[model samples]
Target chain A: MKIAIDLNGGDRAPEEILKGCLEFLKNHPREKLILCTTKNEPDNLFDLNHPQITVEYFTHAVGMKETPAKSKKEKPDNTIEGTLRLVKNRKADCAFSCGNSGAIILNSVDVLGLKDPNTHPSLISFIPLYNRPPLAVFDVGALGNYVFNAELYFAVLHETVDIYTKLYGVKEPEIKLLNIGTESWKGTAEHKNIYRMMSDSLYNFTGNIEGDELLFTDASVIVTDGLTGNIVLKLLESFNVLLQNFRNFKDCKFDNNYLNFLIEDFNYETIGGAPLTGVNGKVVIGHGKSSSKAVRSALELCVKYAEI
Target chain B: MKIAIDLNGGDRAPEEILKGCLEFLKNHPREKLILCTTKNEPDNLFDLNHPQITVEYFTHAVGMKETPAKSKKEKPDNTIEGTLRLVKNRKADCAFSCGNSGAIILNSVDVLGLKDPNTHPSLISFIPLYNRPPLAVFDVGALGNYVFNAELYFAVLHETVDIYTKLYGVKEPEIKLLNIGTESWKGTAEHKNIYRMMSDSLYNFTGNIEGDELLFTDASVIVTDGLTGNIVLKLLESFNVLLQNFRNFKDCKFDNNYLNFLIEDFNYETIGGAPLTGVNGKVVIGHGKSSSKAVRSALELCVKYAEI
Candidate 1:
C-alpha cells in the first residue's frame, strides 16, 4: 500500500516532516510513500534514488494563526491539500500528515468527505499509565458542538480498540467508556444511552469512568464524544506534565530528563494520524505541532489502520 | 460553632479520630466537638481523654461492606445517623464523617434534607493540579443521572467557590467550565449556553478550558457532572497511589516515618475526603478503606469547611 505524505502544515513543516518520512521509508522497505511538499525542490532534499519513495512540490502551506476554515479555503495549492487529493484520487491508499489537525480534518472532510454523517475526524490519544498499557482516548478536540449517537460511538470505540490492541499486542483489550461514574448508567443523555447500548454490546465496556479514572483504570480503550474525550485526554497530558514537575521539585532537578525516562517515548505521528472512522475513503489527520517523530508514527498507524 | 464527629470510621476509627478531635480542641478551644461511636471505649485497645471533646457511644457500627442505603435504613439508630441528627436538630452546626460517603449523603438527605430541587448532594473534591491553585471538582459519584444544564452547574461552582475562598483565604476564586476544547463556541448545546451565562454572570468566569490546559491555566474551580468528576478524581487518586508505590520501591521499605512526614509535618492532608456540596448541612465522607490519617484529614477538612 502506498501513503501520500503531507510535507507542509506542522510547526517545522517540510523540513522535519520530510526527514521523518525518509527515515520511515528506510525502516519499512515493503511500504511505498509519496511525499507532497511546498518545498521549492523536494528531490533536492533527499537522494531521490529510492524506488520506495516519490516527491511532489505544491509551493504553499497554511499558517498556524489562520482559522481552519480560512486556511483550507484560501490555500488550495497547499501541500496538505495536495496530499489529501492523492488519497481522493486513489493514487495513495491513505494520506499521512503532520499539519494543523483542524485544517487536516477540514480538508479531509472537504476532499474525502466524512465517512458518515457523524464521522468527523477525532484525535485518538493514548497514555502509558500504571500497570495498564496505553489507554486510547479518542477526540483530543475534534467535535465542538457534540452529541454522540450510540452507533457512531460504537464504531469509534471499535476502531480504537482494534488499532490499540494491534499496536500494544495486548490480549483482549478492555474497552471502557469515558464516563462520570462507575455504574453502567451515568453521564449526559448521549453517554447514558451509549452505556445502555454497550451493556448489551460485544465490547468489554467497563461502564462509566470518572475524570480521575482516565489515568488509572485498566481499560485499553476509553471511548467518549470528541468534546469530552479531548478534555480528558488533554487532562491526562497535563497530569503527566504536572507529575513530572512535582517529581522535579521533589528531587530538585533543573531538567525533567530523569522523570522522562519513566514515561513512554511519545511519537507524534502515532497519535497524529487520527483515522476518520466510517469514511469510505482512507484518511487521517495529524497535528500542526508534529515533530519528525510524530510524522513517522502517523505514517505507521495510518498504514496499519488503512489495512483494516 | 460545634461539629459532631464520627470517632469510629477508619482503621483506627475512634482512636485516631478521637485523638485528632482532642488536638483540635486543644488548639481551637472556641470550637467544640461531639464524638460518637459504637464505642469510643478503650480496654487497653485505645486511649481517649479530652476534657472538651464529648464522647457518646451509639453501640452499633456500620461495616464498610454494608450498602449505605441498607445501613441507613436498617441502622437508623446507629451513630452515623444519630450524629447527623445533631445538625438537623441544630444542636451542632454540622456533622463530619470519615466513614462511607454514600452513607453520609443518604443520611444527610434524609436527616438535614438537601438544598431543594435541581441540587442534590454532590461531592466537591479539591484537585491540586496545573500551575494554578487547587480547583474544586464536583459530583465524584454523588449521583447517577446527569442533566446538561449550565445554570445548575453555575450554582455548584458558585457555592463551591464561595466556600473554597473563605476556607483557603483567597480574595476571589476564578471559575472555568471543563470541556474537550478551549473554543469560544465549543461544547454541547447546554455547555455553550452555560458558557454564555457564565461569561455574562458576575462570577470571575474564564472561557472554555481544555483538558491539556487544566494544569497550566489559572482557574480555581473546574466544574463538571458528578460521574466525570468521580472518574478524574479517582484516576488521579490511583495515580497518586501508584507514584507512592514507585517511591516505596525506591525506598525499599514502607517508610511510615516519611509517610507521616507528608501527613503531619507538610500539612498536606495525606488522606482525601469527598464533601457533599450544596447540601443543607456540611458532611465529610471518607474512603471505606480509610486509614488513621485519612480519617484525621477528613475530619479536619470538614471542620475547616464548616468554619468557612
Candidate 2:
C-alpha cells in the first residue's frame, strides 16, 4: 500500500514530518510513501534519497491563519490539495495531513469529491473511555463554514453510523445527540428538530447525551455539529495539558506508566489520528502540533483505512 | 438579610435543604431565612420553629423531566417562583435554588424581572484556575431557549462586563468569544459576525478562545451563547468526576487537599453557586445533585450578592 503525506502542513512540518516518514518506513519497509512539500523547500533540509519515498512539490502552501475560502481561491495548487490528489489519481491508497482543519476539509472535498454530494465531510474520531469500548465522535472539525440543515445532518448521521458499524463491527450502535441536557427540550429549537429527525430514522437513535456524561456514556456513537464536535474534541485533548499542569502544581511525580493509562487515549501521540469519512478516498488528519511519533501513527492509521 | 431558599428543588430536597439551612444559620446567626416548599410537603418532615426561619408553601413544583414551557403553563405557582417572589416583594434580600435551570430563568424574569428587557438572563460563574485569579464564564445556562440576535448578544456583553467589573474590580477586562478556532474566520458566518461586533465595540475584545485554551486563558471574561456556555460549563464540572474515576482506575490515593485545590472551583460544592445576572433581584442557582454542604455554600453565596 502507498500513502501520501503532506510535509507543509503543521507548525514543525518538513522536519518532524520527514522524521515520521523515515520511522514509518523503517517499521513497514514494503510500504511506499509520496512526500508532498512546497516548491521553495530546499532539498538539503532533509535527505529524501530513500527508494521507498517520492517527492511531490506544490506551488503554494496554506498558512495557519488563512481562511479556507480565501486560501482555496488564491493558493489553488496548495500542498494539502496536491497530496490528496495522489489519492484521487490512485497513486496512493490514502493520504495524511496535519494542516488547518478547514483547509483540509475543502481540499479533501475538491480533490477526492464526496461519496454523497449532499453530505459534508465528517471527521469521525474514536474516543477511548475507561473500562469500556472506545466511543466514536463525529464531525470533530469538518463543517466549520457550513450552516445547519436537517438534510445535511441526516446525511452526516447515516455516514457516521455506516462507518462506525463497519470499523467497530457494531451491527446497530446506539446513536446519541450531543446536547446540554438529556431531556428532549434541553437545547434550542433547531436541536429539537434534529432530535426528532434522528428519532424517526431507522438507526438506533438513543435520546440525548450531555457533556458531563461524555466520558462515561454507554452509547457507541455520539453525533454533533462540526463546531460543537471541534470544541469537545479539543476540550478532551486539553485534559492531557491540564494533567501536566496539575502534576506540576502539586509538586509531585506520578508513575509515568500509570499517568499514561489515564490520559493515553486523550493524547494524539497515543490515540494517533482521526478519519475524515464521507469522502470518496480514505483520508486521515493529524493534530497541527503533532510530533514525529504522532505523524507516523497518522500514516499507520491511513494504512489501516487502506486495508479496510 | 433575609434569604429565600427553595426546599422543593434538587435531587435531595427538603431533608438536604433543611440541613443546609441549619448549617447556614449556625454560622450566620444574624441572617434570616424563608424556606419555600410545596403545599403537599409533610409538616413533620423537618423542624422550622426557629425565630429566623419562616416556612412558605407553594401549590406546585417543577420536575426535572418537565420542559420549561410546559411547566410554566401547567404549574404556574411553582416553588421556584414562590421563592423568587419573596425577593420581588422585598421580603428577602436574595434567593437560591437547585431547581431546573430553565424554570429558574423563566421564574426569575417573571418574578424579579430583568434589569434589561432586551437581554436574556446570563448565568455567570467564577472559575478558579491553577495559578491565576478566577476567570468568569458567562451565560452558562440561561440562553438555552433563546435564539441568536445581535441586539441580544450586545446586551449580554454589556451586562457581563458590568457585573465582572463590579465583582472583580477589573476596569477593562479582556473579553473573549468562545469559538471552535482562534482565527477570525473559524466558525460559521454568524460567529464571524458576532466577532466583528465585539471587535468594533469599545470592550477589549481579544479575538476568539478555543475549548482547549478554556483552562489556560488569561482573559478575564469568556462570553458565549447559552447552549455553548452550558456545554462548556458542564464539561469543566465533569472533570471532578473524571479525576475520581482516574484515581479508582489507578488504585492510588493523592492528598485530598491538593485535589480539592485543582477541582474546587469547577464543583458546585466548592464554587458554591452561579448567579443568574441581568435580573433586578439576586438569583443564585446550585447543581441539581448538590450535597447539603453545597447547599450551604450556595446560600452563603447568596449572602455575598445581597451585601453587594
Candidate 3:
C-alpha cells in the first residue's frame, strides 16, 4: 500500500516534511513514499539520491496566512491541491500533511468530497487520560452553537467510536458526552435531552463527563461540538506554560519536560493522527505546524489505517 | 440583623447546618440566629437552647422530594414560607433554608419578590484549584436557555465576585468568561458577543477560560450558566474516585483518602444559595435535598448579606 506525503506544506514545508518522508522509507524499507511538492526551485532536494522518496512536482505554494478559498482559487499550482488530486485519482491510499489546517479542511471537504449524505464528519482529536488510552473528541470547530442534526451529530460520533474501538483495541472504552455537568439534568435543553438519550442501554454510555475530567481521568471518549473541542485542543498546544502555574499553586514540583510530555500525550497525535473517518476517500490530517516527529507519527497512523 | 436558620436543609440538614450556624454565631457573637422550625415533641440540647438560636415555630416542615409549588400552596405554615413572611415583615433581616431548593426559590419570589425588575440571580460555587484560589462559577441552573440578559448576567457574577472578595479578603481576583477554549478566536455567537461586551477593559478580563482548566488550576471567578458550573463542580465531587482509578492504571500508590480534606475544601455553600440577584427583594435559595450543613451555610450566606 502507498501513502502520499505533502512535502511542501506547513510553515517549515519541504525540509521538515521531506525529512519525515526519508525517515519513513528507511524505517519501513518496502513502502513507496510519494513526496508531492511545487518546484519553486529545482536545486534543493532534487539531487538527494533516494530511490524510495519519489517526487511529484507542482510550481506554486500557498502561504499559511492566506485565506483557504483564496489560496485554493488563486494558487492552482499549490502542492496541497496537487497532492490531494493524486489520492482522488486512486494513485495513493491516503494523503498526509502538516500544513495549513484551514486549507487542509477546505480541500478535504471540497476536493475529496463527503463520505455520505447523512454523515457530517469532523476534526477529531484523541486525548489520553491518566490511565486510559486516547479518547476521541470531535467537531472541534466544524460548526458552532451545537445545533442542526444534534442527534445525527451524536450518531456520527457513535459510528466514529465504533471504528475507534476496533482500531485501537479498546476492550470497553466508556463513551461520555462532554457537557456542562455530569448529571443528565444539566446543560442546555439539547444537552439535557442528549444526556437522557445516552442514558438508554443502546450504547455503553457514561453520564455527561465534565471538561475537568478530560485528560486526568478514565473517560475514553468525550464528545462535544467543534467550537469547544477545537478551543480545548488549541489551548492544549500551549499547556507547558499552564503547568508551571499549576505546580506553584499545588506547592509541589515535577519535571517541567514531563509536564509537557504528559500534556502532549493527551493530544492523541502523540500516538498518531486520526483518519478523517467517514470520508469518501482515505484522508489523514496532522498538525499544521507539525515537526518531522509529528509527520512521522501521522505517516505511521496512515500506514496502520491503510493496512486495516 | 438576624438570619433565620431552617436547621433542616441540605444533605446533612440541621445537624451539620446547626453546627456551622452555632460556630458562626459564636465567632460573630452579636449576630442573632433565629431557629425557625417547630419545637420537637422530645428534643435534645443540640436541637435547642442557645442564646442566639431562639425558637420560633413555623408550625410546618418541608421535605426534599415534595413538589415545590404544591408544598408551598398546601403548607402555608411551613418553616420556609414562615421565614419569608418574617423577612417581609422586617421581623427577620433574612431567611435561610437547606431543604427544598426549588421551594426556597419559588417561596422567596412569591414572598419577598425579585431583587429588581430584571433580576434573575444565579448560584455561584467556589471551587479550589491548585493553580489559583477557588474560582466562582455561576448560574448552576437557575435560568433556562433563550434570551440571556448580558448586563444582568454580568451583574449576577459581579455581585458574586464582590461577595467572594469581601468574604475571602482577596483583591481583584481574575474573572473569566467560561468558553469552549482559551484561544484568541473561539466561542459561540452569543458567548462571543458576551465576551466582547465583557472585554471592554472596564473589568479585569482574563479572556476565555476553557472548562478543562477549571480544575487543578487557580481561577478566582469562573462564570457560566448554572447548568455548566454545577456540571464541573459535580465532576470535582467525583474526581477523587477517578484519580484512584488512574493510580491503579499506572500501578502507582499514593495517599488519596489522606488528602480528602484538601480535596473537599471547596464548600458549595460558602458562596451558597443562588440569589436571583436582579429581583426587587432579597431571596436566598438553597438546595432541595440540603441537610443541616447546607442549612447552616445558607443561613451564614444570608446573614452576611442581610443588609445588602
- Per-candidate Cα lDDT values, in order, are 0.66, 0.78, 0.63
Better of 1 and 3 by lDDT: 1
Residues B1-308 of candidate 1: C-alpha lDDT, one tens digit per residue: 77887766655576666656655566566777887776535644334455556666786776644567778768877778867888888877768776665667778888887586666466777765422346676545554455556667666666777777876676677777777556766667877887887888755877777666765667777776454555556655654554553443442333344433322332224435666766787777766555555655666676777777
For model 2, the local distance difference test gives: 0.78
What fraction of the true Cα-Cα contacts (under 8 Å, chains A to B) does candidate 3 also have?
A: 0.18
Q: What is the DockQ of each candidate?
A: 0.41, 0.52, 0.18
Sorted on lDDT, best first, the list reads 2, 1, 3
For candidate 3 chain B, the 10 contiguous residues with the lowest summed lDDT are B243-252
Minimum summed lDDT over a 10-residue window in model 3 chain A is located at: A240-249
Better of 2 and 3 by lDDT: 2
Residue-pair clashes per candidate, as listed?
25, 0, 43
Q: After superposition, how far is residue B43 of candidate 3 from its true place, in Å?
A: 3.7
TM agreement with the true structure for every prediction = 0.80, 0.93, 0.71
